[model samples]
Target: MIEIMRTMVSYLGSDHKHTALSGGDHLTCEREQGAKRHVQCSNTPGGRIEQLEPCIDGWHCVMNFMILIWQKLHKDSQEDYGTLSSLFARIGCSKAKKPKNDMHTCQAAFLKVFKGHIVTAGCKEFDIEGHKEVNQSLLSSVAQTVVKEFTVIPEALLGESVIDSGDKVHGYARVLCHFASLVLLFVDAWKEGDGERVIRLWKILMLHFHAEKKTKYALEALRLQFQLATLQPYLSHQLTWGRFINTHGGLGRNIPCDLHNEHINKLYKNIISNMGANFTKTASTWAARSVSSLHRISMAFDSPWPLTSRLTSTVKQQLTARGQMRRTSRQL
Candidate 1:
């Protein structure tokens, strides 16, 4: 990345020289100096916004740190519960394949069966398939979609937090969802440069975190709070992170999430899982399918992707028949 930036700035320098010879406007010498400084030691930033953005986003900051907390917490919980439940056992999940008992397969078949996700639990949704590292895009979407949806109160349920703490299933789900929401909000505030808002969210969740003081998550939360408290004085004066950009030159809009180029990752994983060792002619096959999918989306997305679709009529009938068969077998 440093090399790329060096090449880019060098090219920009040559371009600037040409513009100056042609009597065109050019970057000031100070701007050139700042760009060079930005590419230097990323950790010891020159405090310029140009230097700050790449510096902040280049290394793992709040986003990476918080994700590590969530990933470990989520994984540890999953290990105790063991394998994911069968799709047919999950109420609203797709009913397509036989008892292979695979969550990934169920997710894939869901597109065909219901034209949507086969997710039974909203708050528990995670990316990275539990085998890989926590994915940044997954974390991004979870905060926006999953956490947002879970936290928003319905009009009828407004002003009520009636989830029974004693109830095993719903109680646990509620706590997980609420905590996830807190983390995401803190993350969003930091990313958007709302320092006061970040501190406010931390304060709101402070009591709840204290209540769970025995947990590792609470320790992580407190550690984060301490870091934020130290920054409170600076944040009060600085206000938005954009101010840093205006005054300095470092903190830009790039995140070193590292998943920016992984379309082939998905393709290879899918082909290997679905095709196994029989990969002869499979490369061209999936590639053609990929192109065909692109063409369909370009010309006839509405046909392929309806605005609304329910469980297919045939799948519904099959479910009913299977229910009847189970009943008869139980009776016999």
Candidate 2:
């Protein structure tokens, strides 16, 4: 059986030159003399085996071979008749002096070959339309088997298997499906008023992904939580604003300042507000501190200036500190 399967797979895998042997709606028996000559005698005393010529239409032979194999393996019901009938009707003629027309015999021959290959098997006939139903059932069974295999990994991992990059991307898709399912469960819990269960699932999700990827998955998982209203407090706080700022580069600077352009100022104000920061106050404080530090640093650099002399000793020390800060900031 394995050898037969291997041979079939090889044929299916290859598209190279090979003789086509079609027994379409007709089977032909070879004359024993010619058959023996072709099979055994490559070069007789005269030359290559005589009277062995290629078929008139060889593609017919190849199609017949494929259909015949499919029919014998899968076509057993009355339903299959519709599918295989046309092929069955085109059986080849016998390969002999008086070649006989016997398409049914050819179909039977194909079935016999297939049956012999797999096991002691017999065709269990069924109605033609039933073939589609049978096919659907077979597909369903295969799908179930694959899903069952996939479901085992989560259970085996104790619900902690955070899919790493080491896992296949297809497996990552499956993990995504699993996480999505968990999100659904959390949703159900919320719908049922099971607040604890919702929180529990959210925490599990966070912990699993957190431990796995060092918070790489945190934002995405939390985003899922937001939709469910199960995201933990401080998690939103933990949502690093750097992600947004870094995205904008220098424009990502969080410093707030009075802008002459209303559009630009409003845009900055909106962004800071949405990020849960006090835009006006935060910006003013930042700017004020920046100016103060600049003034002090300038005094520290050029001593005994008119404004520098009036500044207090404490202010002078602040200027020295600010000068150091300016130098450090520039280096950065």
TM-score of each: 0.28, 0.20
For residue 61, give model 1's deviation from the true position in Å: 9.5
State each model's CA lDDT, in order: 0.37, 0.34
Candidate 1 shows a clash count of: 16
Question: Which candidate number maximizes TM-score?
Answer: 1
Q: lDDT per residue, candidate 2, 1-332, as tens digits?
A: 22322333354334322222211111221232234345455454213322222111111222233333343332333233222222122222121111023433443333322222111111112223111344554655554433443322554655455343454523433443343345445434533434455445645655655654535234434544453354234332222111111112353232111111222445445445554545576675465445545545665877765553464545322223233323222221
Error of 2 at 147 (Å): 5.4
List, residue by residue over 235-314, the lDDT tens digit for candidate 1.
32432232212222344332212122123345545545665566666564565357535544555757666567776656
